[model samples]
Target chain A: MAIVVVNVMPKPEILDPQGKAVTNAGKRLGHEGFSVRQGKRFEIEVGEVTPTVLEEVRHFAETLLANTVIESFEVCS
Target chain B: MRVGVVTFPGSLDDADARRAISLTGGEPVELWHASDDLRGVDAVILPGGFSYGDYLRCGAIARFAPVMDQIITRANQGLPVLGICNGFQILCEARLLPGALIRNQVQTFTALDQPLRVESTRTAWTSAYWEGQTITIVLKNGEGNYQADPDTIAQLEDEGRVVFRYLGNPNGSLNDIAGITNQRGNVVGLMPHPEHNVDPTITANLDGRPLFTSLADYLLGATC
Candidate 1:
């Protein structure tokens, strides 16, 4: 079986409150000058990795896994 | 008039929406997410709550439910539809309405009786209220912040499609928008739970009663 990973992140223009909260916590913990942005990762299990499979997964990521209006997704094998 | 309230898994306010419709002298029909049938209702309401456990994203999974197919088809055909809270999110995801609802800017789930001004009374759902009328309704949710592209925002403003604007600008919504309608004014989506404020016995105010009454008035006038 092959696995493909898709990562989704909030668009830069959209607010990422969770990421900001985490960054604030890091600051409280004495980690300064570093920032973090949060996103979601999805791993899809497939019988085999092929061009068609990759395309299909990309479609899934775009249509289901991520809302394109506020987020962007990347498909990785 | 008959108003249908769709109930998806984890929906908490479907009953309240139905009750509100009934109180407004309209028949209430219950629609299920797993069914494609709309039961021939004159209007449909998508109520608040976490559907499909709010998985992936709020209203994202519910947008693909079987019932949504029927709702989308009917809504595009000029059927009056109202989406509240999570329902608003579903409407955006279904592209029935412009913009997406994101997490509150403060990163907290906010619940309050929010003050809002009627921006436009041209929509099927807001015709009972006069333009610029200020009213208060129950606002409760985590992802209630509304956002859209600059062009879409401009178009909405230019067209006077903004239905409701928050008087106090809670949750950091763009232009203080609490609700909006489509170009045809048949479909509207808002983050506040108007159904929760319809009954004065249960709630302290009846500010939401006008929303249901407005739909009833529209349907009655349409049939006349």
Candidate 2:
């Protein structure tokens, strides 16, 4: 079984509402160093997960997990 | 015609999408996230909302849903696949459509009756409108601006793949693109909610009705 970690985010130019909301809230609370965005992680156990299998998994994540419009994904084993 | 609408965990518009299909004279079948089968539907619609609560990006997590596998396979076989908002994001992630929905350059979640120019009536969806015709539909999303590398944008422009353009730039999308059709013209992705426009009780504009109407016309024996 291999573990996969994926990080997804809107491309730099895109506005992140959730991030912005957090940033604003941090400012209100006087929290320092608040530059925040969000993404997710999924851990799955697969059989002999070769590179091709990983790619397929990534494609699956691309098609379903992350919205490609605003988010990009990177997969690590 | 029978249509399948896939439901990701956080999908918010699956029910509405089904209702829209019913209103348009298509039978809507619900497919689950983990199942790879398409339930023998003629077309597929990836509805809007934060799948996985936008946990890993809007449509990121939903892309891996088993149903999408079937969708991608059948879409290549010439099945119609329509992605709206978050659904559009999933298509982009899937590479079935090029470009990405970035955060609105203005950084705002815009929800309103947005005006769009029908750039092409050549796809499985949006076939009811005349080229260059304008219509209004509801657009509500936080990350909906469309962008791509310079060459890709130019290619899309040159190919006339752009299917919809904003009547007025609302999300800071390049060239005001609100929707696009894939090379085969069977897959389409748009940021607006045509489903919301199907019922007058739900939306002020009926402009979105044509989207479904055209789908009904073609899927149920109407001309291209």
Candidate 3:
């Protein structure tokens, strides 16, 4: 079995209110000099790890897992 | 005409949508999210709610439901579909519409009887209203802020696809767009709940009834 991981993040230009709020809360809690950007991670286990399967998974990640209009996604093996 | 109101597990306004359809002289049909059948309805309404508990992003998981597959199919074939609030999110996630609804810029859930201006009435759902007509509808959602690429905003504006614009820019949407229609004009997604204001018993003014009546007329006219 092969595990495919995808990270979906808000585009850099889009405002992430949750991440900003968390950043503010973190500063209040005494953390300093750093920022956080929130995102989603999904791990899928596939029965077979053929090149065709990987390509298909990439298509799914692009079309279903992430909306490219305001977000971008990365696939990690 | 029969209007199908889809009931996702967490849909809060399906009944209201059904009632609105009835008040506008159309038959209301209940459709299940887990089933692919549309019951051969003339149109479909994805009512507002936190479907799939809004997990992993709003409408992210629900967009893959079996019913959505068929909805997308029929929508491509010119089915009139209206997505309200969370339904709007689903439409965006399904890529039927062109933008994403993030959290409100103020980071708070906004609830109000907001005024909106009908920017265009060429859509299947807005033909009953005159251009520039103003109406009041219920708006309540945490993730109602709309965002898209600049080019997409220009395209939407150029194509005259923006059907509704907020009079007072409540949620910080780009171009104050409260609602937009697909290129074909048959599918629409909006951040307000028109169904909630369709009846006089619920709302003092029946501003939302025209939206339903518009759809009813469009479908009936198509058959005649």
Candidate 4:
């Protein structure tokens, strides 16, 4: 079995209210000259890693793991 | 006419949707998310709430429910389907509708009586209203902001498929689009809850009554 990790984030063009609010709070707390973007990370445990399994994971990532309209996802091995 | 209202486990507005249909003189059939059967209802309503506990993104998980698979098949066959608020989110997630709904621009949940103009009367749900008519309905959601690529927006505009446009920007939706219909006009998704405004006893006005009545009329017309 292999572990698959995926990261999902709001598209850069879209307004991310959560990220902005966090940036503001950081500024208030004296963390200066830095910004943060919030996103999600999912770790999955699957059977043997093969090209076919990887392709299936990619399909699921595009269609279900992330909504391409406003968000993007990246699959990491 | 009979309208089916499907209730996801956390649906908050299923009862309201059912009541709206009953008040409009249509039989209301209740369907469950786990069930694959549609019970042969003429139309369907996916009422609003935090389905699947709003986990992994709003409507993301609910879109894969067993019932939604059948809903998608029937919707493609031209069954009249309406998705409100969280239901709208689910529709987008399911790819039954275009675009996506993200967090509100204000970074908080917004709840208000949102005013909107009927942009088109060509849809199965908005046929009772004349073009350019204005009405108010309840809009409430944490992730109500709608987004889509520019080309898709142009297509929706060029086709005159936008069903409702906000009178004022409530959640920073692009083009002020409060509601939209698919190319076939059989499916619609909107952020506002028309069901909340259907009964005068619950609300002061009945701006939403027309939507239910419109469907009832359309179904009756189809049978004749």
Best by lDDT: 1
TM-score of chain B of each: 0.98, 0.95, 0.98, 0.98
Candidate 3 Cα misplacement greater than 4 A, ranges = A46-53
Instruction: Judging by TM-score, tell me the better candidate of 1 and 3.
Output: 1
Mind sharing the TM-score for model 4?
0.97
TM-scores of chain A across the candidates, in order, are: 0.97, 0.78, 0.91, 0.92
- Docking tier of model 2: it is acceptable
Q: A1-77, model 2: which lDDT tens digit per residue?
A: 67667666666755565677778799889987788875566776777668897898898777565655556778877
Highest TM-score against the true fold, candidate: 1
Query: Rank by TM-score, descending?
Result: 1, 4, 3, 2
Q: Per-residue CA lDDT of candidate 1, range B117-189, in tens?
A: 9999998999989998999999999999999988999999999999999999879899999999999999999
Better of 1 and 4 by DockQ: 1
Worst 10 residues of 2 chain B by lDDT: B215-224
Give the candidate order by descending lDDT.
1, 3, 4, 2
| Candidates 3 and 4, the one with greater TM-score | 4
Q: Which structure is stronger by TM-score: 1 or 4?
A: 1
* lDDT of candidate 3 over B1-224, digit per residue (tens): 88999999899999999999988889999999999999989999999999999987788888999999999999998999999999999999998998899999888999999999999898889999999998999999999999999999999999999999999998789999999999999999999999988787766978888889899778877788
Q: What is the model-wide C-alpha lDDT for candidate 3?
A: 0.91
lDDT of 2 by residue, B81-193 (tens): 99999999989877889887777766778998888889988888877889989788889998888887778789888999999999889978888899998988889999999
* lDDT tens readout by residue for model 4, B1-224: 88999999899999999999998889999999999999989999999999989998899999999999999999999899999999999988988889988888888899999999999988889999999999999999999888899998999999998899999988889999999989998899999999989887778978998888888777777679
Candidate 1 residues lying further than 4 Å off, grouped into runs, are: none
Q: lDDT per prediction?
A: 0.93, 0.82, 0.91, 0.90
Q: What DockQ does model 3 achieve? A: 0.73
